[model samples]
Target: MSKKRTGVFVCHCGTNIAATVDVAKVAKEMAGEDTVAFTKEYVYMCSEPGQESVVQAIKDNKLDSVVVTCCSPNLHEKTFRDNATRAGINNFTCEIANIREQCSWVHNDKAKGTEKAIKISRSVVRRVNRNQPLDAIAVNVTRRAMVIGGGVAGIQAALDIANAGVEVVLVEKQATIGGRMLQLSETFPTLDCSQCVLSPKMVEVKRHPKIKLMTYSEVQELTGSVGNFQVKALKKPTFVDPDKCKLCDECTAVCPVVVPNEYELNLTARRAIYIPYAQAIPASFTLDESVCLGLNPIVCGKCKDVCEADAINYDMRPETVTEDVGAIVVATGFDLYGQENMGELGGGKIEDVLDGLQFERLCSASGATKGHILRPSDHTEPKNVVFIQCVGSRDPAKHCAYCSKICCMYTAKHAQLYKHHVPDGRAYVFYIDIRSGGKGYEEFVQRTMEDNDTLYLRGRVSRLYRHNGKVRVLGTDTLSGQNVEIDADMVVLALAMVPSKGTTEIAKVLKIGRDKDGFLAEAHPKLKPVESVTAGIYLAGAAQAPKDIPETVAQAGAAAAKVIALLSQATLSRPPLIARVRRSHCTGCGMCVDACPFIAIRLENGKAVVNEALCEGCGSCSATCLRAAIDVKNVTQLQIYEMIEACLAV
Candidate 1:
């Protein structure tokens, strides 16, 4: 019940705060507060000497609590708290008042800004007065990691984690692990064969002892918290046993059902029993259950009969497998914007017109026309090709407002590849502006324009439609102040990259957030790009935003390193600032459980119980509790009330 000793430190932040708010006046006013035994103003409180002064004052004045009035706590809260710990005071006793972002930055009036800064500092001082010493909560770790998605990002993350001696569970929704990256003929900049670079990594994932690759599978449910998570993954049956199947083509030859091959982007037909590609991991065949004739022996038995290895199993059913892991990495990748939505362009209706991926297929050796750049409608080589960029990007009125970062570079790569295939072919590109912003990317685009003689027009295409045997492109050349028209044999649309359908579904299952554009949201865009809002969860590749291959791989490796660091810990230290339930306040209506987003609250023995490890200290449970029995540890209702009173005090 004795009076507490508090110290207040105001920072000038090199005119960031001093320019608008009078730091010296704020410090002088805080010194008059009853509990404030020490007060100081520093030019830069976050600098080494500034921090040393704070620690020295705490020691000399015997301060029990401290408040630092400066920039956002997000940037320097830990620095000041560590200083408190260094000076033998409890770290929880230190608090932050964001005078820069909340006060100075927004206001130009010096007098009003100083007045507001004083109020902010006084409010934090009141909050820190009631702050109690608390220790970090320690939770046991599972020492394993799960990576969702089987693209280059997922594969790289899994491989990196596995290489570090941590067990990995890799789940893929498709029949194979290659994802969209495998479907491309060549990558941008260097123009290396996509398969040749990625296939080796896929094979490494298949052979790695520490990695358990689960293809034709999906994560159905995720439960538990950071250091301990239970994942229920539904492994759909492929109907062809991987171990028993031979690499022979006899079964696919006899299958009667023919469907559009997804790997070929429907540019080719495939049988009911087929392998994704010759270099598919596991080297097995898959029976497309959706399009196949009834799996009954009386209905369709040709594939079973033709399989000399007897690998076909008609009675196979979906099985759910459970995995326990400490951390999870989401690398769900991306999908192109649906072509059906582009009615203004000849998309999904015109055979010769294709999206970027389909064009890559046309250039692929294993594609429908055997690497020939022939028009799909007439099966003849296209003498003229038109490439359009920003088809569904940077058009705030109708499409995505943000730029699809890879489109500009890839569009240039597409033009260069087209010219390479057909030496005499004329290539035209219609774009708003070029955004080739990577190492060697700008040079590559220049080479394509100068060496390949590809014409770059600064304009937006108005409309595209089939005219006679050729497709007519209607657009304007803004640089030339002229309207332009082209009768092209083939037109390629560089559709915007969007979060895949699976990425959306998985976000809900993982209880993570998605941005307005539907990409997974990072915890902090600059400092914590790979970390998701949820603890123990990380993001990589286009699932976060549209990015190129090199960036994707780099992010994947970074995510893997984070996982390795998390799992390597013997016990994880969670923030002690989680919710706590007051058992004496009785009624357990279970409302807190429903209101909790992280699934951190539960009713036990007809009373609310909070799992400290799972709680994010968001105060949702406390707000939903009508009895006021639940509260976050450090940010209690009493502290909030006292802080509000101090802010209102004239």
Candidate 2:
């Protein structure tokens, strides 16, 4: 509402900014401009006395606002803000010119860099002159979280949060909570049954008073921000409602329609109205919408007629349930690459070919053919089995340049499993680099070779094709420099790991940015790996990158810690630099609203109001202001403009 008696402090940053730019020349140059009280350049403006210098200058010059031309605001905007605020000026009155990263870090020519830095300073001064005093906003955190996946990571997150005495909603896309872990008979190296370790946790999740498990459900839409997120979950009609269905098989026995069971990776058949598996959580049966006579084509309601509990609802339609949560952990695990992604690997075309997950399901006792590995084409067993490694992953030529870290271990596990079950089965593995870098990982792979009698070939499988009923794998052994071919009863492809197809969807929903590969981008690669670049949001599991079980679990725990720490605060503090609306001058064209991926801006009392919690203060919204009506606090155009005018003092 008032003009700030602004002081501008330009940082030389020890040649990081000074070497290319004539810092003093530009500082003097900008001091000659109007609205510029004084301008000076210091060797290290972010240092202790350097920061105090700005505060001293603010006090000495009787300045209400200060501009510091230094590194990206991401680094030290807050430092200047804090210094200015402590010096009896509003923190938002301190504007930062990003000369270091945007100018000096990229540009080599000194004169050009100095000129560019001055221009940037001028822009920030111009923008900040229109700044206003804004208060931070906070909503009551519900002390609740919604975790979308029920896998080990999700389960761990739910258990931790529930144990912390917070309400948790654990939603599973499947009928059970164990996820891919349950598909495995035993974990590598430890040789412990996956279900034995996971079932107790699953049961604990079911019994936890603070935890609500929503199985066979999907989150349809997510609205709001951290501490105030509203989610709508579409409870796909299971036909057999949990409150009424007793999980009895009487209805399944009478159902006429049967299809290849997805639970068994399509190696077995399930009735049209079948429970996902014997130990399906909530233990409720689901009628297949595609095949149920009544629901499928509106032809078969046979399972309903014979039902004693009257659980069948033939007209059951998708229902939406909305809940408020303080935070969201996107544990929506991952799906293995299907036939569509593995065209070069002879994926669905071969009856015996399977992805790593399908192979796990195929070998389980609950799987099709009852744990006897056989070709789907003929159900016959053979002596030779070949495992193709890096099928869809780790191929730079295919855009999967980075290794999917889990493939090597899991492929090795599959080979050992085949060897264990087939007794006389010969298991051979082809690979490029064996990345068993996790704890107990190298030994696990070694044990598979030594103890399990599995052979490992260091190379790639160039091609795979079906001959007669069996598939043949052809590749070269890089170690021996020999062309190798194997005809096998079954061939398992360790498909490449890519970010989930929903990665982009989650990014949009969160209003966070993602890289070209679609995995979540961290705040910094080395400094802040678990945290997203967007404040108040954290990342976990394969959603962040390709990781094995251990790494994924560890990241999940890290994400939980971040959430707990954030919620633990009495109230969160945001950066003083945020986009502010000039209400009288505002047109409310909604350009800023549309441009904001975070949904930070909304109409309040018919005028624009920015939810400080949602705003990232990226200045994208300010740039979109048609009338230049929107200016970011502290870093307004006038402040930047004057700072530039002062920097280029002629």
Candidate 3:
């Protein structure tokens, strides 16, 4: 047996630590430890020169392990580990002690802070002494990628990945590829027709040779790991065969079953046999099974009989398809905060008061009223329309505490569009604050107020109710310190943006995490915005957070680039820090299997086995093992005990 030599490098962090702790004394004390062969203090241990100094110290002192006591490992652990590898030592032998965030930053006394820093550094040094050098596990990759959701974000991600010479399977939960964007009339700032901008991309996705378009589909099960994932998806039957459905309107006219059209936000009626819109991708009709009489021939078969092309299939059933992919992008998009939750604002009971999406439908050219800006209650043009911003957002007590980022700009756009439709009509906007923080956004809001003569009231609406054939809005203007009331012909609520339906279910299926507000959680808020906690899966658009089209597209492109970079490699190098079972202590209680969140462990022949590819090194399995048979490599129980002893050593 050979003795281990450890080197300790303490960082001053340029007064971030030195201001509160004695860096020189801490380095001097660390040199007295048994395994520490060398110790030094630097102004910034993460700097290029500081890293060079560490490399030189390792080679000069014949050190086998290194510990860098500095900032969080998240920022510089990899840097120091790479430095160790460059100096001809195993990267696994390098460890980080977070002295700045955990010690100096939180402590006011210099003696206590320095003592805590020493304890933290000594704990990591002890752990590193016992660390065995390990190599990264390599796994072969599949060359395909799956993108969930067919919104703008998903479409852009799919196109980018496919353009990079990788195959893509694009899945949409709707009958058509276009998502919520297809239901919009026009976009903000530029005022371009939403469909006009998105239709071309929809066409491109359908015609791309490297892309497989799967509409009316949902991911049922996701298993496997990064570089090789197995996916089971359910392709829901639309009944109308897309290949044979000639976009003729005969079936819709003959159908007796009429349902509220979801595409129009239920502001209009649609036949059970109908297409989403005129320019729907795959351009076919979908038979609604939920509302239809029956799929059997004995039930009313009006749609099938009237179908001249015989596209309607009575025997259509959901088909499960399997796919193997290296990576996945989740761009499931968003849904507005339900208007039914707003009880004070009539809880969707007021006929003329509508939510933002419904207003978009009313303003759309292909909408129910043909872009007339008519009130839904009477089908007449509104004389005075009131737009309320931040309906269920930024209200911590009863609703979402976070600001819906797009609400302010969209509400301004709504007011501007209303003025465009009714030239002589009045538009009033009630808002907490105008948060037009994008390019040309502030100017657009200004233009709406100055040019269009829209009155902007700075306040929150207290109550809203229908009175005397008009929607009455009662609010207080905080800026003016006055009570304001308006009996408007129509009112629009700028509801908050929430994660689209099935976001939570999909997060559980993919083993990804979600934030407190229910959007998918990123690995890091700033550095790894698009990357999910799960290795192979990425996030974009409102599924991750509230964002507009340009931001969503940019994030989608970023996620695609990450996927491309990952799939471009012939094989992926995964961290070797995974669970390992000790066969001697075998009692295969299956407790570890039940506790493992990643499903990385399984009992094979009454012995617990670990799948290295699936394990995230979370240590949950190790914690659950009563016999202490299971442990994560490099983070074993012995190393943890030594580190804990070192920490408590006075």
Candidate 4:
């Protein structure tokens, strides 16, 4: 509000910005301005020494505001903020001018780039004068966690939080918790028994004193911020008593209605009322309400009549549960892209074509085919099976641009599993690349190639057609750069791994960011991989990105560590950079109110009140208001305009 006393620091950026623009000339030109307290330039202004210039100027010139003309704010805003705080200046008093990425990175002409940089710098100075110092609103965390999707990731997260002496609520949409892992016969590389490794985690989550496993449940509404969140979980009726039933197979064997078994990937017949698999967590049976006796009541309660536990609750109704939590881990995992189309690939049109998970089940000892590589059309063992990879991945033109990171490894694993099961069975794997990049990953691929007698052909299939009880595959060999065709008794498609179906829903509820492909977006790729853009919420497993078991487990640990870090604090302090409106300025015209994005602005005491929790410190509200009443603390309009006046000599 007083005289404009400004300082500008231009970064050489090691020729990133310096090569095209004259940093020293720009600084000197700005220094000539009467309002400018001082102007300086340096190489790597983001570097330690460059930051020192800002602090030194703030003290030496008694500057009222600071502008760091560097790269994008997204990269190092926090760094500059911390520097300002260290200098006894309000962190928001500083503003970052994007002269590098937006100007130097895009423009080649020296003078034009420099001119554009000045314009941006001037705009920021104009904007920052309106900025005011705002404090971050810190709410007490409940110290409880919610994990979505009770697969391995959820199980691991729940166990970690529970083990740490905190409460965890796990929600699973399915009636069981095993997820696709239970469907698999063996895990890759080491080929360890899938259930053997997964079952222990599931049991721990179910039995944990601090963990509440809610199967057949969906999160209907998620509200509040990271530390103190309230979630409404919808528990759909399973029609069977979870407490009474002891996982006896009696109900399934005698049920009158028989349908295709989804657990077997629908390869065999199963009663309508049945458990997903033998090793299902909770290891209990579920009644398919659509076909079960009690649904219409027209049919008989044969399952209940047969059950000695009287576990059947015919009057069961969907229930809603509200739980409070301090943090959340969205490890809902993923689902394989359903290859229902690509009629040429025999996706849903043919009987013998199966996805990777289905094939996993078929290869398992507890599977429909009893660990035999058999044709679902007739239950006969197949002598030859063709594996198709990248069904709906890596092609932006068709399915998705992402590579679905786990597909290549899992397909190789599938081929290896097929070879192991049917020793004499010929396994031909069609792939785009072998992406076993993690620990023991490369060696695993080599072992599969050398020991399994599996044929690895690098190519993409053009078409597939079932003829004479066999599918004829037409493809091109990328290695040989030649067209190839083959007929196999059965075909296994390694479908693309995709984010869970409820990913978008969860993203909206949690307010955590998500990229275009539906995978949860992290705050920063390298620096904050496990953290979501939203604080107090962490992500792990395939829900965030397509990751293998080892990576998923490691991420689970990282997420747990983050929770522990948050809990470690004796008293959380909200950073003093969030937005707040001046209640006394009082012209409730509502222009600033409409501009607030996070709904952090509220009508409190009959006036427009800016909620510290909702404000992003973006200063959008300050920009739109005609009255100029809105101020984003520290980086206020007065200080920024002073900086601008200093820069322009106006």
Candidate 2 weakest lDDT stretch, 10 residues: 292-301
**What overall lDDT, based on C-alpha atoms, would model 2 receive against the true structure?**
0.77
All candidates in order of lDDT, best leading: 1, 3, 4, 2
Query: Model 1 segments beyond 4 Å from truth?
Result: 18-22, 100-116, 587-621, 648-650
Clashes of each: 0, 40, 0, 19
Off by over 4 Å in 2: 1-63, 104-111, 296-298, 573-650
Any idea how many clashes model 3 has? Answer: 0
- Models 1 onward score TM values of 0.92, 0.86, 0.93, 0.89
Sort by TM-score, best first: what order?
3, 1, 4, 2
lDDT of 3 at 74: 75
Q: How accurate locally, in lDDT, is each candidate?
A: 0.93, 0.77, 0.92, 0.79
Summarize candidate 4's per-residue lDDT along 290-318 as a digit string, tens digits.
77655654567677778899887788898
Worst 10 residues of 1 by lDDT: 339-348
Q: Give the C-alpha lDDT of model 3.
A: 0.92
Better of 1 and 4 by TM-score: 1
Residues 41-72, candidate 3: write the lDDT tens digits. Answer: 99988889999999999999999999999998
Positional deviation of residue 598's Cα in model 3 after best superposition, in angstroms: 5.9
Model 3, runs deviating above 4 Å: 14-29, 100-117, 584-621, 624-627
Provide the RMSD of all predictions against the true structure, rounded to 1 decimal. 2.6, 4.1, 2.5, 3.5
